[model samples]
Target: MAFLELKNIYKSYFLGKEEFPVLKGINLDFELGDFVSILGESGGGKSTLMNIIGGLDRAFSGEVLLAGQKLNHSKEASLNKYRRETIGYIYQSYNLIPHLNVLDNVALALDMTTLTASERKKRALDLLEQVGLQDHVKKYPKQLSGGQKQRVAIARALASDPQVIIADEPTGALDSQNTEEVLALLNKIAAEGRLVITVTHSQHVADSGTRIVRLADGKIISDQRLKPAYNAKVESKLQSRKLPLVTSMRNAFKHFKYHFKRNLLIIIGTAVGLFSVITFNGLGTGVKGYVNEQINSLVNPKQVLVTPYVKSSNNNQRSSYVNLTAGDKTVNTFSNKDIAALKQVKNVTKVEKIHTLSNVATSFNKKSTNITTVTNWTSVLNASSIKKGRLPKTGEIVIDKKNIAKSLTNNPNSLIGKTITLTYTGLNKSGQKATITIKVKVVGLTESSGSSQINAIGGNTIENALKAANMSTDVAALGVSASSMNTAKKVAKNINKLKVSGKLRFTATAVSSMLDRIETYISLITNVLAGIAGISLLVSALMIIVTMYMSVSDRTKEIGILRALGESKRDIRRLFTSESILLGIFSATFATIIALAVQSLANSALSQIAHYSFIQISLSNIISAFIISIVISLLAAILPARHAASLNPIDALAGE
Candidate 1:
């Protein structure tokens, strides 16, 4: 049986909706160790015949058998395996991988083989030696002569120890001497008990083959055998070929190196957008946390604040209120009746009713400091911590740590039990001064609450001193606390109702609403800033798409070559898609690092300004940014990969 056979093969194509037959019925057979050459004119479909035989094209309707197994109409995967393991192909154009050195280029076929790196390297070197390219192993294709490049291509084809070697005008680009050398190599291949077939237009090449098959317009017109020509020396030389294994990795590394700069630029560009997104989200989280902490720090978690509402005594008076003045027509700011009513609410607990007096001054040793005074001693003292001494009694004073540290030249402990004279000037009774010579012991010293104070004075002690000095007049505001926040709020509502009924002149409801409005405005500003930052992400997506499209175009010839080397269309698509996916991964990783750096800088700046700690990035934000980047990259790569896979191999090769 013949080692290879083609029977009644026919191939056709459509030209403007008209069927154009490229190959008519054809039959051929080849035995092992046969050197056959098919000579044809241009446009005679000689290349197409070689493509069909090499499994690069399967548009023909025919039966092709190799080693007694049918090759025609087989599954694509099976054909790919056959091409990978059974046949070696040499193209006239060399088709060396531009990025790889000669040795790596030659070892490309053996990448999928079960050979070790050393084994693949050894085989590639041996093949290069056989083809007389041993000295050019480290040189890229562009640096080598046409003959040397073709020799490398031949070495590549032979890397897998294929049974049949198919040469499509293999020596067409070589000089006369180089052509002779290549032709002699092909003849030597056949002498090693392998089938060598060549498609050519050269009479010299045709005459060199043991058998000649002539094709005219895609049909075989002659099949003739020439005189036996065998070379035992060449056979022995060719059969001595051996391969090393490391060349596959070297090829992959060369490919990566060639494309590294462009890919790195793409990665960095993508990372910029991801960094913005991550940083913004991180800042939001950090700011929100800070706000919550500040609020919680100032207010007790179990406490609720309540305010009073005022109503006008007369309809005529309400009409006179054209503008909302500070002192309204009527409302009891902190009536004792309201406090009594609040004590009746459900879950009622100890409630502290206190009034504030602002801008009261205390004089000691001819130095005076301004302070705010609160009326309640027991409830206020119980809720706060005294850093030193104890809560003040009626005749004692409690000062803040700041006042002790800043004003007192003597020991704070000695000053604690010392007497200080008090003087108060009433807000209502302007220019009226009141003085009280009270022999008061200094008691507790505290850190300033909610707001800072330049001097120390306890809420209860200040109010008592004012009263003693006959400076007590109107109450500024009130503080209320209950067993729980819910109970406190209920009591507060009741107090508001009492203020409305009593028609007092002060109300606390306005202050609470003002604070709420401030919070709402801050939230609005944050959202606006976030929305603006989000626009950059969309731009990043477009950038990814453009980059991937450029990559597809740049690697078109490479994709075609892989397809011609028996890679399936799926494999071609996957290669491009994988490259894009890897780009996304790299971008996201770098972007996360950039975001963290920005966060650190932001935190440092905020700490210096606010005297507190802050964080501007969070793990969740990083995760979200990565997910968005990956999705954008995958979406961007889809169209480019499809376009790459759909490319016509013939056009791609021709363009190259």
Candidate 2:
């Protein structure tokens, strides 16, 4: 049996119902080390027969046998392996990938083999030296002469260690001198141990080979022989495999580097969108932190102020139940029973009955000030808010600077040691107003907070003063304390659910609740801003899709060359997707850099005034952005990669 044989092969093309026969019942046999030429004129089905034998066209009826084992041309995967392991093609136009250097072009086919990277490179270098293009290894196809290009093509064909070499007009585009060189190389390839087949119409080219088979009108007309075939010794061959992902990524990076100027613009455009999202998210986090800090400085974060449940006219829930004057007839004071109920709340460390008086007339050393509001001191007050002196003790009063500093004394702290007479009306336990006049020592001065109640007296002092007049000791408000800010909020939430006689009894307000509303607003704003940023990302993704499609159009011939060199459709698709993923990665990297720079600059500037970092890009944000970029780009390349993969090798090779 022949080492390679084609039996009863037939092929045709269709124009609707009409048929044009290209090959009619062809039979041939090949042995190792035979330099055979298939000679024919144009449109004589010479190329058609070559396509069938090369596994590029599987629609032909034929039995291709290698070593008595029949080849299944109809099975695509088997055909791909067959071509990769058994055949090498040298095209008339050279068909070298323009972007690849001579050495890389040769090594391209080796990517399909199960060769180590170092081994593939070494073999490719050895093959280039063999073809006498060692000096031009770094030169691209466009930089080489016709002869150099053909030599590169020869080296690439032999790189995969194929058993048979098929030269489709190997010397058709070369000068006479170059033609002689290329033909000599093909002859040497056959002489070594491989079957070398050349297709040509020139009789001179045909006579150069060891054997010639003439074809006309799709039929073999004559056969001639110039010499006997050489005997080849058995040797190891390169095994074939699918293109590896790392190799695909490397190729993608090469292409990405090749067109850096164009791709840089894409990266910047995509980065802008990602930058916007990162900035907004970071800004939201910072804004929330700043607001929480400011409010925390004014009140104790772990303390909640509870008041009678007073629903506003718009039904907005009231924040506090503190009353400053006996004129506030609307509020029901907290009895010992009510305070006990609040103490039962979970997570509550302790609870204190809160009392306050409004319109308190104070006379201190002949200088009188009408204190607009006064409340019993509790943990609900932030100690930092005390601008001077300490918190009020049992017999001491802390007066706010609002009225006391200007109207009562030159220095507010000076009044801290003075004895002040306080005259005010308080509600008795029966809910009737009673007049009270008392002397209290001023121990502390507080900042002029714009709240309704700013003056604070010790809780015991106020309760004792009320009892001295036989007035109501019952308090209008309660202050509940918890371990932490989070726990305080939880306790407040539970406090709102507290019921007296099955009726909602109290309304609780914690500084954290205000922070919650602030954060919610910031989050909603951030998400809106991020969504707006996503629109740009969508545009960037579309840009990637369009770019990949244009690449498919531009590299059509390169795709064909790879297919002819034994690459499967899956390999071709992965090649394009790999490039897209690279684009995505580069874009995300650029975005992260841009976001970080802006974060630093913005925080530096904003911190001078706000004393806070207003932009905080997290590591997770950067990572998530990269993942999003890669995923979007990969999805964008799907249709284009599939389109490139589906291209017919014959048609693509013939593409301009």
Candidate 3:
């Protein structure tokens, strides 16, 4: 029984409905250790017969038997296994992957073996050494001469220890000297217990082999035996399996690195979109914080400003004029009953009487200025804002130096112990308006801390001055203070819920309320900006798709070579997808780095103004950016990878 047999083979081609026969009935027998050369002219079906024998052309009607076992041409998996485990092909063009070096080109054929990484490297090295190209292992195909590239191709074909080697015009492009060397190498491979098949038109080349089979117009004309076949066993202990995912990833990374500059640009472009998204989110958080800092620091955060609910009477002045007896909207004041009810609320640690004396004539050293102060001393005033002196006593007042500085003196501290008088119209005990004057000593000078501050005086002094003028001493507003800032919000909520005869009587406002309002606006604007930046991400995804498609086009021959090495279509798809995902990972990682850098620089530059960070990139923000990048890239790669895997191995090999 023959080691390999081709029985009555027939093949043809078709264009529309026209059939063109390429190979006539062909019967041949190939044995181990036989260096058989198929001698024929161009287009005589020598190469087509080699394709069938190598299990690369499955569209033929024939029986290919190895040890009397017939090859299953109808099933692709069986053909792939036969090609991988038994047949090795050497093309005339060398078909080396341009991006890979000599050593990697050989090692790639061993990807389906169960060998460890180090073992695979060792085997590749051994193979390169065997081919006498050990010194050129690191060189690319373009860097090597014709003979060297052919030697590398031969070494790659032998890497998997295939049972048969099919060389289609193996020395077609080589010089006479290189051709002799390659033919001698083929004879040596046959002597090492493997069938070596070479297709050639040169009689000299055919005469060098152990047997010459001449074909004319797809029909064998003659078969001549030149020498007896050598005898040896062809077997290796190497176990084989399907290609692993790690191999695909490693190959993907190799391609990624080979095109580093182009991929880097893509990654940077992608990072721009990711950076914008992260930065805008951080900006929103920072702006809210800065606004809160300014507002909360102005007064005690635990203070809620409570005022008597003013009615529509202030607008309807004519109606007030008609109902005028002693009560009016101008003196809308909080009664003792209101203050008592506030102190009863939870978390209400303290409450103080507050008076707002607007449009009062304040005089100091023959200089007069308008006064708008909550004149009564209360906890609502941030004590840390006092520049000098202390809170006022019974006959003393604390003046805002920033507001009345020009009206008083160049140095306001000098006027701290000086006398100041305020004149305002007030209702007397008899319910008639009268002019009142209050003489008070300026004990302290305070500055505005990012928020409005008023000129303040002791509440007792104001009440006594009104009493001296025989005017009604009415309380205007109350300062509701809580135990903590958070408690202050709760206290304000409770206060607003208070009503008189089921009518809303008072409204309270806390520092957090103002902060929340400003923050809401900032958040809305930031989200809008971030959303707009997200469109750039879509553009980046499209760029990845284009890049992947270009990659598929560029590596078409490499794809065919890998398929000939028995790599499954699924492996090819994963190979391309792996590169895209790596692009996403690297892009997201670089974006995070950029975000951190911008955050630090922004915070440092603005430290002097608000002493706060205005851009705060969070961990979640980075994670979300990575997710978006990966998902987009993975989706972008799908069509291109599928197209690459769906390619015909024969056509791909023929592609330029």
Q: Which one wins on TM-score?
A: 2
Positional deviation of residue 505's Cα in model 1 after best superposition, in angstroms:
18
Tens-place lDDT digits, model 1, residues 506-535: 232322333355557655766567667667
Candidate 1: count of backbone clashes, pairs at least 3 residues apart or interchain: 22
Find the 10 residues in a row with the least total lDDT in model 3.
316-325
Question: Backbone collision count in every prediction?
Answer: 22, 4, 2
Residue range 590-645, candidate 3, lDDT tens digits: 99999999999989998887667889888888899999989989999999999999
lDDT per residue (tens digit) for residues 250-319 in model 2:
8888888888998898899899998898889888888888777666656788999888886555667554
Q: What is the lDDT of candidate 2?
A: 0.86
lDDT of 3 at 446: 75
lDDT of 3: 0.85
Sort by lDDT, top down from the best: 2, 3, 1
lDDT agreement of model 1 with the native:
0.67
Error of 3 at 595 (Å): 3.7
